[model samples]
Target: MRKLTIVAIAMMMIVLTACSEGNKNGQGAANDNGKAAAQGQDAKAGEAGSDAKQEPVTLKVLRAGITVTETEFNAYLADAIKEKYPHITLEWVEAPEDVEIEPLITQGTVPDIIIASTTAATSDYERLDLVEDLTPYIEKYGVDLNRLKPVVLDTIKTYSPEGKLSVLPLSLNLPVLFYNKEIFDKFGVSYPKDDQSTWDEVIELGKQVTKQDGGVDFIGFDVNGPRNISTGLDLNILDPATGKSTLTSNPGWLKVFNVLKKSYEVPNYIGADGRYQYANDDDIFFNEQNLGMLAFNLAHLIGPLEELRQQGIELDWDFAPFPNFTENLGTNRSANVHALLVTKTSKHKDEAFQVIANVLSDEVQEKLARTGRIPTIQNEELEKLYGADIPVLQGKKIENIFKTEPRKVIKPHEFESDVRKFVDGAAKRIALEGIDVNTAIREAEDNVNKELQTLQTTR
Candidate 1:
């Protein structure tokens, strides 16, 4: 009986041991299954992440008239774009002189982006319905429009009928009074105050410097054109409400004509044959080096001046704030913005806006400012950095360019370009033909009215 009981006990112990081994094996199998399931999930997640990566896209950028060369575009914008978004490729489409935007659209090749002047934005783009409102994209991207100068924003808004933010100003052209130091020194006339001179004061100073020296004629002052002088007065050529020329009624037009007429009336300014010898262009100031002072576009002159310096042709030159009308003291020329816009037909608007935002980034803006293009943003430090990269602009009083605030821009009429001819003619008749301001204004008004009527009939 004792032997049978021991045998039962041994059998029970063996059964218990087998049960313990089976439980351990089952737990190990469960753990292995859990690990395999986790690994499968991780692999699927990796595939999903790969699929979610952005596809590469090529965005075509049209250069309408902003003077951005391919090399400059690559250096200033394209490379930065690549670093930020490896997916986007910027293709620069340079519009030939004769190539119109309408033809490009009909060819099914509308560009994703356009770089153009503010004037072009108001006229060409508006006429063709090519601009896309960037307000929504600006919100989506958190683009800080507040960083830009208020005048620039105001000018851009004025161009739009509904005040939609269609374009972002990249840079602006501010007029500066460029003077030949040699001419001032020759006449023993004091240099024009950097930011304190008025148009009347400048004209009187021009009288001091206007003389024949060394058998060469030195004109006291000349403007690039009537347009340059008119900008400071915020003169609009046509009244938008009536679609008629404002030359006859706007008192500012009379001031503009008088200023030019006074400058040309300086002694020996008109040639012996009863013709105005000094042309209303930069050639007199830059090449001939005879004109004492020239009110011209600062942004447009930087490249040429830099090139001249590089070629070892240096001029004894300096610049002052653009002379203001006595009544409009402390008012600079109206903002002339060069803007970047996303086209209405663009499929990659988000990406295009990202590009614009990147360009307006502080780093890019600083770099561009160093190259002498005025930044649209209102950073004093950035403004101080102007012309830091150009050897010619070193030690120049570049600060004068920003002394006066830009005037609030008036929206130009569609006929503004057409009307400019009559205004120019009036100025020519007054300066060269010795016509009276009242008579010149009347002639300009009559001619512009006739032209507007013709344009209205044709359209």
Candidate 2:
């Protein structure tokens, strides 16, 4: 595995070098607006209702990450596409990671479509121009963008240039508060409500439940942080206007940290050795039955619980909307969605888009949602039907998945990664090393600026 990873990285370097050359040749920096405008004109000629000749073509599909497999794709979406366009054939190619496809793109052998994690599609790929702007295709096809959840669409747009949605999301992970109902019931504490819960109120509730009861050590709340919580807080770690670090200056960030500080400071929440009182998060929540609540994604509601049941343990759990900051109430956390993008180099742009449109249709969305893959669609009626195909989630409060609106993300730079690391480290300092929150934030701010300066100088 190590050797394969090394080879993958080495291959990626060569591919990137080749792609850099291709980009310099002018094909890579093609203006997205031009494409959107041209596609819009073409779309006018070829509306979905129009009797346009459907061409026979084969589309090469590249699945970049483990988010979806060819087996699953073939089962869920392949035949549906055929039913819509019998002449268009999909050639599916799955890569262990996205970088493996860079070689093909560099060789002028681009796949018609690329499906990947938002992280891989947006940041990991350096050549944004190679990914086609889907705005025109969407307009031409008359694909209803609003049918998808607003937050998911907003996140996809963040990856585009000039606010053009170059990629269309398929599945999304919405952050929410997952709680073990049995634990709440055992403590006689009221469950967190969707619309009314605030961070301060939730923390107070967590304190009341964080206790040793009947020989079981119950933790009021546990979450994997600070990235997860920071995202939920909708805290802008960077100044979007200037694309600079706001580690110390963002007042909202301090409030977020304050809430997290209170969480870790709950008596007996963390052991003296800087670990949870129980063995681990899964064990603490699933087996020991002690964790009262966890802030997590919708996907966790399906896979992890199923795994525990297979191990002869079952958790009586439900989820609520992620608690909001008092000031940021009603604002949703950004959806980290897995989206599909059309490659600019594809000869079958129209056909590629047809496939995408078909996938995002209400019918397909419902089918995907039933598999515990949350659909990007905004239909509230669909909420009642989520996890319908998954037997384990039959009676679960899947409605919590859509509790909050999706938060919009600011444009991010590579330096934002450094800022996240610095702040996350500061969080550790506050929780484990007993540093003052303000002092830690200030130190983190200085350290991040220095790091950014070093990065700039080196560049």
TM-score: model 1 vs. ground truth:
0.84
Range of the 10 consecutive residues with the lowest summed lDDT in candidate 1: 1-10
User: Candidate 1's residue-wise lDDT over 269-336, tens digit each?
Assistant: 77677656353554566677888887777754566566566568888888898888777788778878
- lDDT for each candidate structure: 0.73, 0.67
Screening candidate 2 with a backbone cut-off below 3 angstroms (N, C-alpha, C), the clashing residue pairs are 333-407
lDDT of 2 by residue, 1-459 (tens): 222333323323323333334334643222354335435534553566367666678998887763464544664456567766788899887566535766776688778888887756766553556677778777777676765567777777776666567787878867777788887888898887756367778778888788887876778876465566566566666775676777777776787678768877888787646774232254456556777877766643355565555456667787788876676666556567888888878988888888776776555665565555777766555566566545456577776666676668766666677567788788788878888889888898888888878887785
**How does model 2 fare in lDDT?**
0.67
> Which regions of candidate 1 fall more than 4 Å away from where they truly are?
1-53, 96-99, 272-280
TM-score of candidate 2 on Cα atoms, chains taken together:
0.78
Model 1, residue pairs in steric clash: none
What are the runs in model 2 whose C-alpha is more than 4 Å off?
A: 1-58, 69-72, 95-110, 126-128, 185-189, 212-217, 276-284, 287-289, 307-313, 345-347
